[model samples]
Target: MPGTQLTVTLSGGDVADARAVVRALEGSFGAPDELPGDENATVRTATFSAAAEGASGRPAPAPSGGGQEGGRLSAPVTVTVQGTPEAVARAG
Candidate 1:
């Protein structure tokens, strides 16, 4: 059976911060499969497979209780990482 996938989005902060954001995620997910058009875009996005821990050794903090619905955010410096329950949890 196929595994799962995760869509992680990080926005807000200076547009230049996009690089840093992607860098942070690299620890969890390998280099972004895709990236925003503008390198300095405030809103950056990345996608990762379930077994995408070939980037960094750091693991993202696990999420608290409650379900995490995949959706957009209306805030600055917002990070939305969504995927299968397991993938999401792992990415968290």
Candidate 2:
């Protein structure tokens, strides 16, 4: 079956909050398919990283020019959830 990717972005400073949210999601949805059991959904992968320059609306500055700081504190995470259509719909 097809899967869904849930991406959540938060301020880089809020790492704790981000982790908490991930834990909560895990508790609610159970683990992703790769984990082990069939009862819990599988999580293909969970990644956390700082937003790169120009990733957001703000663009990076030219070589000799000055611009707003491109490297702002931002956290971007991607979680992959896999399950049947009924399960997915219910989870949604």
Candidate 3:
């Protein structure tokens, strides 16, 4: 099936946090094709491949249980979503 590709930017974010975000969004989009690395760069990126919608018009699976605790700074973060209109809408 033709799917959608999504690119998300995690600016001034940590890998664990980014992973958490990915986990949280797994329901909308399947596991990311590219997950953030362990590097704590000022900016990072993650690529995800999604099916737009799940079976029987239902949403995808929820994220797994696991995360870290820590405060973060409100830095500039950007998100780039690209895919079919329907897929994009579903991801959004």
All models, RMSD in angstroms:
9.3, 16.4, 3.7
User: Comparing candidate 1 with candidate 2, which one achieves the higher lDDT?
Assistant: 1
Over 1-92, each residue of candidate 2 has an lDDT whose tens digit, in order, gives: 12333333323234433344444444334332222222233222332122212345232232331212443324443434444454335334
lDDT value for model 1 = 0.56
lDDT pick, better of 1 and 3: 3
Error of 3 at 62 (Å): 2.2
Candidate 3: RMSD to truth = 3.7
List, residue by residue over 1-92, the lDDT tens digit for candidate 3: 34566676766556666666666566777667767886747666766654444655555676555644442323434555666776568657
lDDT for each of the candidates? 0.56, 0.34, 0.61
Instruction: Name the candidate that leads on lDDT.
Output: 3
Please list the residue runs of candidate 3 whose C-alpha ends up more than 4 Å from where it truly belongs after superposition: 50-59, 68-77
Q: Point out where model 1 deviates above 4 Å.
A: 37-42, 50-76
Q: Please identify which of the two predictions, 1 or 2, would achieve the higher TM-score against the true structure.
A: 1
Each prediction's TM-score versus the true structure: 0.54, 0.28, 0.63
